[model samples]
Target: MMRTLFDAELNKLNVDLTKMGHLVEVSIENMIDAFKHQDKTLAKEIMDNDRLINDMERAIESRSFNLILRQQPIASDLRNVTSALKIVTDLERIGDQAADIAEIILNFEGEHAYRTVEHIPTMAKKAKMMVHEAIDAFIKKDLSTAQMVIKMDDEIDSLFQEVKQEVTEILKENSERIDYCIDFLMIAKYLERVGDHAVNICEWLEFNQTGTMNDHRLI
Candidate 1:
């Protein structure tokens, strides 16, 4: 009976963490959409939505730690709940990074977008997909999927580098557009950090699964 009760609590913790991740994922998607369209209204909406993710993050942290203390979970069970705690922090940080990107969009105010950025949305889409896959992998206990998501980080990084190079070239060719170039580049940097956080959550999930932290999980 005690074991069953412990399992139920752990399951509830996992559910809450995943729900928190989904909310962060939504913020990421909308932030990117707002950036792409230069939509101040949507950007404002994304900034306002950060509170929901923050509240869920705190709740998960409290619950996970409470379970750790009350249950004194065994090795594997300890890993599971502890990982939820760590991953929620990463998720909340990701939400903050996404919000930062939204704020950059807010700065544009119809003046910074020189033409159109074709790569930002694509990079955001891939990064946001990675966040979704990482959360799903944790909830489903699918180590294979988590590994795949970690590997995809390189692609997002590549896109970030590409954006940086393209923006630099544009600024060099046209000194008048330097401000717009800088804004766009800053936005890409935030997106790159978002992808890195996604990778961090994947690593946390893998560590929880194997109770090991070697690079063997890197696909």
Candidate 2:
């Protein structure tokens, strides 16, 4: 029956999304490790692999649109597909932010440069955790998980501010390390943005489940 075929297509969508989420999760994790360790080789590898995330994004977008055309999903089904469309965009951006941070990590001359900038690793951890939890929420349809991810973003933002302050003070006291401090500041900003993208994905997840737009505060 047509209904059975449509159901199968929806399942396929889930499979593809799970694949995409896993790819992004690994990318963020590897990026953070590279940043913390100042591993240019690993950072370069993550940068090179960023294309995989982009390709998966396009593939999912195409499949989602084709399903919308062929199946004419209504109500909850329509919302589900729409949410997939939105979430993939956020997920893709998260991939980009991770790659960008990896590129910045390569600019550091040594591990000591990383040590000078306090709070960056903590920020990276919190942001990466948000992305991981948001994807898990998507896969499991766990509203509480999604809400928790949203709440977690505040922690990342707070850490970012602390990094900014610490870096500014370091730059003022140690003008010689200006360039390195600037790079760390950029990395912190990227992680903050990554956290925002995770929040966006969680919002879409909430919308997909409830058929109502959650306030940013709620999500």
* Estimated TM-score for each candidate: 0.91, 0.95
The lDDT, on a scale of 0 to 1, for candidate 2 is 0.86
lDDT of each: 0.82, 0.86
Per-residue lDDT of 8-54 in model 1, one digit per residue for the tens? 98889878887888888889889867876788899888888888889
**Winning model by TM-score:** 2
Give me candidate 2's TM-score against the actual structure.
0.95
Candidate 2: give the clashing pairs: none
Query: Candidate 1, clashing residue pairs?
Result: none
Residue 52 miss distance in model 2 (angstroms) = 0.4
- Candidate 2 per-residue lDDT, tens place, 1-219, comes to 988998899899889999999999999999978876778999998887789989988999998999889986778888888999999899899889989988887777635655676698788788888998999998999999998999998899899889989988988898998777778888888989999999998888888888777553222
